[model samples]
Target: MNRTTPSTHPSSDKGHSVVAAPVTAHPLAELIAHEIRERGGWMGFERFMELALYAPGLGYYSGGRRVLGQRPQDGSDFVTAPELTPLFGEVLARQVLQALDATGTDEVWEFGAGTGALAEQLLGELGDRIQRYVIVDLSGSLRDRQHQRLLKAHPSLVHKVIWADSLPEAMSGVIVGNEVLDAMPVHLLSWDGARWQERGVALAPQGDTPHPTFAWADRPAPEGVRPPTEHPDSAYPPGTVTETHGQAEAFVATLAQRMVRGAAFFLDYGFPEAEYHLPQRHGGTLMCHHAHTADADPLAMVGDKDITAHVNFTGIALAGQEAGWEVLGYCSQGRFLTNCGLGEALARTGQASNAADIQSRVALQMLVAEHEMGELFKVIGFVKGPWFEAIGFAHGDRTHTL
Candidate 1:
């Protein structure tokens, strides 16, 4: 993936330099414009983001080019761990095994299973260890790719893997979400020196374009809208925009409630409360990805790119705790993978006969390398049943510190 530093600073993102959302002929744009007009000229950023990414057949995720791959040339906006290497899922499966044995459940429920890559690896490695594997994704457009991939990679286990449009009322197994929380719609909260505002979107004409263009609009934060982090923006300069993980936190809470006898684990790039709301990072963490290019402007992309925010681990942990799920552990991706046997996985590759053995080893480095996804991405686990130790968070746990 190609990374280029953006020209605009977070401090000015919503000011004179605020970027415009990419104008596109895509039907999703029309849909959004229609909603804005119907809503009397403004819609919450979270709702706008929901339609942009998961509006059935029109959103970027449900209808755009392949969303997961090595690079944009491969029809992907970005790369994910399972797409990077099979070794990732292989290593993660060991921890799943422990959860299954601990819970005595034979079902594995996976959310946002893009292209079913993780499912392919997990089914291959875990074999008959699982009875039923439920794959859930918001985009029905991706099920075709997932079906074909699983059919070719694991014909035998394909029968066990079923696609569900929604979660079951009850289930008993390990649940996993990798980079999934980041995709959930987030509310944009802005501090304007004196008070907070709920940032939103409105339609307006720009330049010579006859069609409507996306613009930022702000309103007083909804009643009872509490600060996302403890510190808030006590001393940060004005126009300090940030995101609140209400949707993501609600998702964890719902999953925890429905999960009767199993555990759930999520892996994403983020920080605990203190670091997440550092006074230094006055600019919020909202970001957009298009053809591997990173930008702070989500407005410009419309339905052509992926918009995401850093997962707030502290929020996730608190959500789980409120829902009565035990906070198993939290740690960087490097430490989690190491505790789950990434070091041994890499060593085994040294003696493998696969043609891509060396390539696989390199990919592993990118997954856990300190300078890469390692320190930034973290794993957080929660349990509902008799809590069995989460092998992935057995060591170097940073939960207390958070």
Candidate 2:
């Protein structure tokens, strides 16, 4: 079970190099290729994700390359809001307050705390309001940095920030995950009218291969889930594609079970069930990020690239229900922030007495505007306790059948 980039030659017809550049060698790529070869040159989206995100030492998130949020250096790949400013956490603090009063829990756990900036701001805003703060991430390299950041942001709450590689036993707290679900591995399925199949990556023929290429593998459809819609006649011609994700479902299940008796919020970019199952989305939403460019070649950058799938909210909701957590609210990030007082907060900042204060107002507006990250991203939360009024669902404009 070994693999390597295959060779390709210049095309006589096109007079162009048929070969793409060699993929940078990474331990994760090697390992995944080995597994695929062992299992007949194919793997499910979930398996791909398991290897990509947590394959020992070579996976994307598990690797040492720091491509999280907002602190990327010159020409770096990407950054997130948590890196933008402490104010992001300040706003989140308002939401945490709602969760606290709703769930009757005093603790807050943050997943995938990239660089720990959000935790720092959240702890600062929380102050004594929260009994404890836990930062759960796999990167130990950022632990000391997180401690230092929190110490500076909220000296009083520094000791309250704890680090754990895994969830605590019998925990009851508000769990917040920002941009976490999108990174979860997703299984890509193809609906061929009469049958469904899984997508897989396979090493091309020795002479024809230019790095590894992906192909569809005929396999049993996921149990209990049927095609999005029936396609009679020649709609697919026996080889068309559609996508679904049991992997994301399993992830939601894991989180739901871990919550046991609390609230969990998932914030990421995705469409609801209605648009997600649209007929035009036949190519599927699997994407790869390498050096800031979004493309389909997972092998283009190997260990250095990021691969993600648009979260299926319907699947997540269904899994949550199955796992025993009650779904409380489902809405876009824009509506959720508005409900959490984003408008009022911005207006207050707009009344800034000085130049510096006015600048602060502008930044917050950037986060709330519809043109920015507002409409595209969605936020969903599940609760097991008394809190019930749906926060984001108050706005019905963007609401879907989910």
Candidate 3:
């Protein structure tokens, strides 16, 4: 990606230590500020977020693959499940293999293949069983890193890996996305105790503030101001801020259309429809990750960190269903992994004392623990053409919850 400009910021954000942001003003901020000026001095938060996180080479995700890792020393904002342990992918492979066997396809399409860690784990474990591994990414920035990783780590099977900037006319295989949907940009809606408005960002004058700022500004929700229909009762109190899942829902709608004969699975931390739109959650889920620290301010750093929002499984399920795809199942990561045979995998490791083995065990435990990724992270499966009882949902399918 040919980014607009470089970014420069301080090493700390709001008194908290973080990955040192550029000392000088980042070029991307200048470009975005100019963009805001051109757009009548205001840009919707969604558009701002999209540009900040996916603006070619300038976005947080479009530059490097090392941002996804398990340790703080990895120079990453946060660690995903795949970065935690090989067992994460191994157990997930069991679920994918079953889906492939059921659908009678040998291909695996992965979205947002971070660091190619999960890809390596899947390819290594699946072996000759998987004929092709297609990585579909919008940024295309990780191609070189993924290619080198595959070539060096699995020389013989490296030929099976391919990268695509766009989706094929139709797909017929197992599709997987881990911690992917949460990163999709979300629309922020605010209730000001009286009316609804859309929250957005506007550029601050060149010398108005430090760290090159984009201040929060609100306007009538574009077309006929109104809150989302997810909650028609208007039960939310004043001063409430919530998010609408248009991007995530739209992505699923498009995926359902392109996928002609296969099942897709997404793993992320989210909640069902009823729980998601709770009035108690006054603040929206918009968040930023920097050096393992979570923060709510996006104005401080332009392109120096990761920004994300929680997934609305309800919106995802509705999109898939509306597009005529079957909602196979939805369950916790722990239950899903257990149903997919995590115990068998752990037993095979045999209480090894080696560092690698010990790390794998710890990761496995974290993946299934009560208060860890186990309960918060969820797995949702969708199918288009052929269908069979997805084994991962056999234990406690929560299709009804969605």
Best-to-worst ranking by TM-score? 1, 3, 2
C-alpha lDDT of candidate 3 relative to the true structure: 0.78
Distance (Å) between predicted and true CA of 211, model 2?
Answer: 7.7
Model 2 RMSD vs true structure: 6.5
Judged by lDDT relative to the true structure, which candidate is superior, 1 or 3? 1
**What TM-score does each of the candidates earn?**
0.94, 0.83, 0.90
- For every candidate, C-alpha RMSD to the true structure in Å: 2.3, 6.5, 5.9
Q: Highest TM-score among the candidates is held by which one?
A: 1
Which tens-of-lDDT digit does each residue in 1-402 have in candidate 2? 000011221111111112332554566666777788998766765686667767766777676666654323443355566564456667767877777877778899888787787787777677787888988877565566677777877787778878887765567888898877777776656555565555545544434543443333446566755544444424543434445667678867887777756788888777777677565555566666654555654545566767766777877888998987887778767678777767776777766788766756665665556676666677888888785675545664343457
> Which window of 10 residues has the lowest lDDT sum in candidate 1?
2-11
lDDT of candidate 3 over 283-347, digit per residue (tens): 66677777777767766577777777777898899999898789999999899999999999888
Comparing 2 and 3 on TM-score, the stronger one: 3
Per-residue error (Å), model 1, residue 192:
1.3
